[model samples]
Target: MNRKIVEAANIAINNLLPTKSRSLYDIAYNRFKKWCAEKNVQLYSENVFLSYFSENAKNYKSSI
Candidate 1:
């Protein structure tokens, strides 16, 4: 990714949370980025998100 996009993504993620939750959000975002890297997913889209969450959903159980 280009520097501008990377910076924008960082800023966007950081802005999604208050200060205390930033670290946790960062961990999840980094993992998603790493998964994208492993899967050679250079572009972002709704399908990519659906695929990722579908594949990983087994690892997260519902709280209800």
Candidate 2:
């Protein structure tokens, strides 16, 4: 059941983005997955996202 959910999420991630931005999204998503594995983060939650982004916030710039 978990495997199927992961597969579906991957498919949705791959298919839902616009063509020109899909590559960037895939790269970012794969990198996040790698980070999760390295940190042994098995579960996804709001805190997971907050931690990831907070730790890497300096790497991104505001569009505004």
Which predicted model would earn the best lDDT? Answer: 1
Task: Please write out the lDDT profile of model 2 over residues 1-64, one tens digit for every residue.
Answer: 6999999999997788789997898899999999899989999999999999987888888889
Worst 10 residues of 1 by lDDT: 13-22
lDDT of 2 at 13: 73
Single out the weakest 10-residue window by summed lDDT for candidate 2: 13-22
What is the clash tally of candidate 1?
A: 0
TM-score, per-candidate, Cα-based = 0.73, 0.68
Residue 17 CA error for candidate 1 (Å)? 2.3
What are the candidates' C-alpha RMSDs?
A: 5.1, 4.8
